[model samples]
Each structure stands twice: as structure tokens, then as C-alpha cells.
Target: MIHNKKEFNLGIALLVLFFIVLFAMFQPLFDGHNAMAYLDNLYNSISKGSAHYVDALKEEAKTLAGYNVKVTMNMEDEAQAADSVALITAAGGTASAQGKALTINGDYVAILNACLNDADKLYNNDSAALKAKYPALAGKDDRQAVYNWYKILGGFDKELKKQEAFAQAKVAFNVNSKVVETAYNYYKVVPEQIKNKIGIVIFSLVFYVIYTMWYGFAILFVFEGWGLKISGH
Candidate 1:
């Protein structure tokens, strides 16, 4: 029941070409990576490139110099407690662990710098060095150590708020959010500037829009050629 043979034939041709392009996209065409996966990695690298603010954060931390804060962080277990103690002592802070409780007293800035240093190492994908420094973490995933940092810092933030040392607590929150979280999530991703991949990035976006429309138009042409129409009654 074709009303226009030429239009329906044109639609079939376009629809066939669309499937061909889609099938090609799913192939290992770009350096053995499918187009979507390559683009996903490209965007992730670009974002990680600009997301490094640890150095700047370290500098800002120095402004909290001379501020002494004390908090007893409650950890999940003795193993985690021992790990926290190591991190605190490395930052030149005094930490004593009893059972699962870790008492910390130190210049918040110095301690913050230590956390940043560890995060920087992870961000650069130098997990071997991080594991080497912490003997307890040997043969274990390095992210476990970073997660300890996250938990310990979260403890610091909550305890500081209780003592009404809001400024110092704010510092903890910022570092946890900005540096520690980013490093943990983007682990092993080599960052690069988006401008370098501008050509491919733009091409992908444009192709996405055009290809979507191509499918829609093909459907519309086919329906119209079959004398189908929407009308206001």
C-alpha cells in the first residue's frame, strides 16, 4: 500500500546506510577500541587533567598554620586504627591508638599536607610506592589505604564540628571532597588537555546528533510514503 514508491525506496536506502554506519561504529576501528569507549576514555582523561588541585590545596592549607586540633577518631578495627596512626605520625602529628580509637593532636595544616601527598601519589598511579611506604598495606590494594584516609578525614570533619572549630573542619571537608575523592576515583587515568583532542571530540558530538536525526528522518519518510499522516480533527 505504497502511496509514493520513490520516497519509500529512498527511506529504505537511508535506513540501510544507517545500520551500516552503526555496525561500523561498534567494530574495532579506532586503534582496537570501539568508538564509544574511546570517546568515553578521551573525556575522562581531559577531565582528570584539569581536576588536579592538590598542589594549590596544599598551598592554601598552609594558611591554617598555628592551628592545633585534637580529635579521637573511632575506626572500624585495630588494623584500620594502626593505619590511621601511621598516617598521622607521618604527618608529624601525635597519634596513639587504643583498641579502635585513635587520638590525634597536631597542626591541621601539616596533617592535611600528608593526606594530600598520599592522594597525589595515587592520582599519578604510583600505588607501588604508596604500598611500599606502608608495610601493613604490602600485597594489598592501594585504594584500601586511600579509603582509610577518606574515613579518617570524615572523622576529623565531624569531630572538629563538635568542638566548633568550623574553619579547620572546613579544610578537612574540602580536601576530602576535592583531592582525596578525585584521586581515588580517577586512579590510573593518564590526564590530557581536551584541546589536543578537539577534532575528534567535536566530530563525535556532531555525528551523534546527525545520526540520531538520520534515524528519525528515515522513519518519517517511510511512514509518509505509505500515506500515513497525523491530522487535527
Candidate 2:
């Protein structure tokens, strides 16, 4: 028994329209992608746009030029150590592998420049250039090359810090975290400015907040009109 027929009917109408809109949201109406996917990509692109720190890292590396560094880092395996040797030598640094222990000795800038170059290529989706530059990475995934760089640079950072080479360590840390890691994770994502998509960005955020509240109110209206309430006995 509905205590208030008009309120109950209004609630029913609101719920009916709510479900209709919800069904439409699941359809591929936004440039061949559903509403959720479109919004997800939009946010990801915005994030990737601001996450590029490769160029800045390049500038910072210049400060460390002629700063020779010597650090020996342990690798996961002999193959990784061998790969590290190839990478370091290609960067104009002398490197040797003895079992799983790899040693690097050279100017810090030379090593860092090579890392920034690789990061820039991956960030720009130029795996072809990266592979071409390092034939050692031929017949294999280019991203694996970047991952090897990441591991090598990370090892360099730890060894530098332990030796109190803080300036060199800081640069290495930024290269691995800001440049290499970001490039790897956001590979192939086309970045976009939030200002360019301001309209939809604002609309989606507002709609998501209001829509859920609207549903709650509709349910409350229905229950109240149907004579459901707390009472003191």
C-alpha cells in the first residue's frame, strides 16, 4: 500500500530513466569506445603528457660530465651481466663481466646520456631506432633492452650511494624512476593536454558524482512513499 501515490510514481519514473541511461553508457557511442573506456583513456593520456622528464634529465646529466665513476653491481644472472657489458660498452664506457658481477668504469655523463637516449626513443614509440642502434637487442623485444637499462641504472644508483657519490647517485635515481620507468610504463600512449579535453573532463567528473547520489535519492523516495519508516514502539 503506497502511502503517497504521486511520490512513488515519480520514484518509479526516475529509476526507469536511470536504467535506460545506464544501458546507453555501455554501448560504443564515444568514437567506437564505451563511455568508461573513453574516460579511462582520457585520464591516462593526460597523465602521460605531464610525466615526461627525459629532456630535463638530459640537461641535469650535463652537470656530471667528466665525472668519472666506478661501481660494480651484481646482476641476476650471467646473461644479464653479459647484456650489461654490451650496453655499457656501447655507451662508451668500459665494462666487464665476471660471472654475475658486472663492473662499470667511465665518465658518468656518457653512461647517463646513453640511458636518456634509450628512454626518449621508447617514450616516442621508436623501438625500431632503439633496436637498430643496439644490434645486440636484435631478434628480441626492444622493451627488454630498456628493462636491462633500468636494472643496470638501478644498480649504479645503489653502488654510488654506498660510496657517497651522492650527486651521481641522484642523477641515476631520477633516470631510472622518472625517465626510464615512466617511458616503459606509458609506452605507446599518446599524451594529451587536459586543457584540450576540459569540457568532457569536467562533465564526466561531475556526472559521476551526481549520478550515484541521484540513484540514492530515488530509492529513498520510493521507500518513503511506500510507508517504510523507523518508528518507536
User: Cα lDDT of all candidates, in order?
Assistant: 0.88, 0.88
**Predicted candidate 2 versus true structure: per-residue lDDT over 5-64, tens digit per residue:** 888888888898889999999999999998998888889999988888877999999998
TM-score, model 2 to reference? 0.91
Q: Count clashing residue pairs per candidate.
A: 0, 0
In candidate 1, what are the lDDT values of residues 138-161, reduced to their tens digit?
867778778888988999999999
Maximum-lDDT candidate? 1
Q: List the residue pairs that clash in candidate 2.
A: none
Q: What's the residue-level lDDT of 215 in candidate 1?
A: 95
**What TM value does model 1 have?**
0.94
Q: What is the lDDT of candidate 1?
A: 0.88
State every prediction's TM-score relative to the real structure.
0.94, 0.91
